[model samples]
Target: MSEILSAPAPQVGNAESWTRREILQQPETLRATQALLRARQAAIEAFLSPLLARNDLRIVLTGAGSSAFIGDSLAPWLSMVMGRSIEAIATTDIVSAPALHLRAGAPTLLVSFGRSGNSPESAAAVDLTEALVDSPHHLIITCNAEGDLARRAGANTHVVVLPDATHDRAFAMTSSFTAMMFAALSIFSGIATMEARAEVIAKALADTLMDADQRMAALVEHGFERVVYLGSGALKGLAREASLKLLELTAGALVTAFDTPLGFRHGPKSIVTDRTLIVVFVSNDPLTRRYDCDMIEELRAEARCGAVLAVSAQPMEGDALHIPHLEDAADADLLIPFILPAQLFGLHASLKLGLMPDTPSPSGTVNRVVQGVRIHAIGA
Candidate 1:
């Protein structure tokens, strides 16, 4: 841990790319996010207390693209902690089939995550939930203070606008994803509980950022054509986000996949090739860590893929990225630090491909704020 703390500062990269800056700014942004949340805890709890008291309230986490993955990563852990089933429904799915997803009779609390808060599906999902649920409450978490979602504060709604730095300028989300994710995790799990853990998490993130660039850059030099991200429990959702980061930053030049380490054996394991790179997010839970280790060892022994890397808080035998001072931390706390290497890898991969990391797609098919989305009326 002392070695990690004393590590030299990150090597500077292309000055023009906001992607690298946003990726590297996570430690600071996350601390800022937690500080803001701490200051607002009284009011936030006042707003959420009544709704949480009700036994029938249904909590739904919704977002689109990377924002959506935040819910995917958090839902399971939060559900267990809160002692209730929490739904992680993507805004894309909610907008398309409101009737199918929304329960008219259930009291609902929609926790919406948006970096820009302007995604058509994000607004549409909130609208659909409001219209479809007889009793609906909204907790809008957004990085954009001026976004449509942030302006949604009302008697039944509360909006948390994160620090401006988290409103990432890059096409793909880096800081925004982790910041928003930390906010949601802190909110649902209790801000004070996370207050104790936040600095440790941030330090681990700083350490990971310090060591990640060169390691990920070296991996990019291998020119692996495919990448797979695997994890379990809360980490499974993280695996999905990691896969998306590589895919988006590389502009889909590299084929990517994500699944639980155990689930990968069922069928997804077939995607591996000698040109493939597989990364496993090793869990901190004793039982889950065993399974994660088993998969990591299995993949390495198979020798089918070009490389297998384990990202772990605890030491492992083979190729691994070790995160410091979080060996006893909850798996949820691991999410932010665990994602650093993947985000760095994506940036390095984009540069290696001769593409701009800030805006990977040359064609206007994808935008910083998504385009070509037409929100339609429910019945029309």
Candidate 2:
């Protein structure tokens, strides 16, 4: 087992910025999220009980950017456990074609994920759902209590506001992203209630953090022009989020891409270069692990990419970053902890590039929360 010890807070250095701080503080926020779920369990159950029992319920998980990726990460696992269909749609897509997404008069529940909860698309998606569908219920999971999505709470809408500290003062989301993902996992996955499985997630993160941090620092120091994150199933969603973190932090200085292990071999492999670092989030399931391992070996043999790494709980034949004590963890449970290293790499890479992790974008073109997004009126 490895130790992810909390060092004394520094006024300067890599941990100086709020983004890095948020990235480092994720384990604590996850623990806090556990407590938040325990506290709100009954009310959440009460609200969801009837909805879960419905034969005609339509649950759509929606958001934008990293927020949208949450639905991608959660939908597959949530759908299987509950034995129902769950759709992950980005708010950007919904706003563009509400008619395609929102079915009229369907018993719908819109789970909208946001860090600040103020993105124009967040509000527009909820409104579009109302305009085109029946009286739809809303589950707003966010860190900001005063943001538009949270304020939209009413008789038919329920909002779960996470810790304020997790709101992330940084321009790029770190803590908020994971915390909200934890919240959703806790709410939607029946397995989250099983103490043993929950322990797998918490303990794996505790042990892996420091080990991953040290390794990631070296990767950033070595430097790379492009990085690729790969995974399958629930982890594919994680890969997308991880890729976004790198792209956003470097302010386009470092190009990043993501795809499933099998999907990567199909043409997308062209993106790989001598300057590329390929990261695969290896699956725990034995069958899926075969494909993941095959990709790792194939990439290593090609010697085209600068480096190849795998994050896995399962024992591997080659050198890899192992998240200890989760050898038997289900793939869904692996999603949360699997992302920490990717997020840390983004932070370290951003800092190494001599950019502020808190404000990666020095110019005003991009923002902490998007600006100048025009939400249009929907009508006949």
Candidate 3:
């Protein structure tokens, strides 16, 4: 196999490429997102105050693909914080079957995350919630201000726009995903303390990026044929996003699998091979971390996977991809930091395959924003 540089930086505004610059710029983008949210705290509070106080309120986090995963990471943490039931549903599913996911007469807050804000389902899901539920309010978090979602937002909607840079030019979502995920968490966690938490996280991420890029490059050079990602709780959603990142950038040239640490043994563990790379998201919880560490040792004993790497904030007795001070943060906060290494891996893996990280698929089968889907009239 030929050796190649993974995610070499791209000159801005040039048509030549994207992934490297966008992926590397994530920590800065997150800082900007936090500032943007902080500036709008008054408006956010005015809109959410009465609605949140309602005992019947239901929160549904909906988006498509990577966007939907934002909900997956947030739903578990936010539900615990807000003391309400929240669900992460894909807009693709909600647009297809609105009645099944939504209930009429429910006071609902539909939080939609979209990078371009123009996906057919972004708008369609909003319509479905409005039509199916008697009372529906919206909090639209998108990078694109000119796109459909931004344009269609009404009085019932409060739009939180991110920095224009997060509308990434790269085919894969990087900065956009992290920034939006952070924004959603801050919005629901009470905007007052967001600045303090974001400060700690942003600084930690900046330091991690400095250390992560080279380590990820070495992993890409290992020449693995397949990759498996394992995580528990909120981190599981991140594992799903990480798997999709590699699968997309490599154009399916590299096979991928994602599951909870315990869930892997049920049947998914069969995907492991000597040519495979295993990426584990080590949890902060003592009990959960035991399961995560157990899987790492189990796979190490089997000696099947090409290498086993642990991504943890704290180091135990041995080597791991330790992020700085992650153990002190809540499980919800770890979502942002844990995602960076996976993003770096995907960027490098694309180059390792001799594929353009910007647009790997020349056949037009997959696209930046999905195309060729004719929306069926579900009367949402």
Say which candidate scores most in lDDT: 1
The C-alpha local distance difference test score for the whole of candidate 3 amounts to 0.86
> Residue-wise lDDT of candidate 3 within 1-380, one digit each (tens)?
10111344567555336787787677678788888888889999899888888999988999999999999978987888888889999999998888799989888999999999988888889987888889889999999988888776577899888988788888999889999999999888877787888877877787898679889999989899999999998899999999999898888999998999999999998898889999999888788889999999998888988999899977765447888866677877888888899988988888777888788786869999988767777653
Worst 10 residues of 1 by lDDT: 1-10
lDDT of 2 at 51: 88
**How far does residue 141 in candidate 3 sit from its true spot (Å)?**
0.3
The numbered model that scores best in TM-score is 1
C-alpha lDDT values of all predictions: 0.91, 0.85, 0.86
The window of 10 residues in a row where model 2 has the poorest summed lDDT is 1-10
Task: Please say which candidate is ahead in lDDT: 1 or 2.
Answer: 1
Name the candidate, 2 or 3, with the larger lDDT value. Answer: 3
Task: For candidate 1, give the lDDT of residue 234.
Answer: 94
List the candidate 2 regions with Cα displacement exceeding 4 Å. Answer: 1-15, 191-196
The regions of model 1 sitting more than 4 angstroms off are 1-16
Candidate 3: Cα lDDT at 60: 92
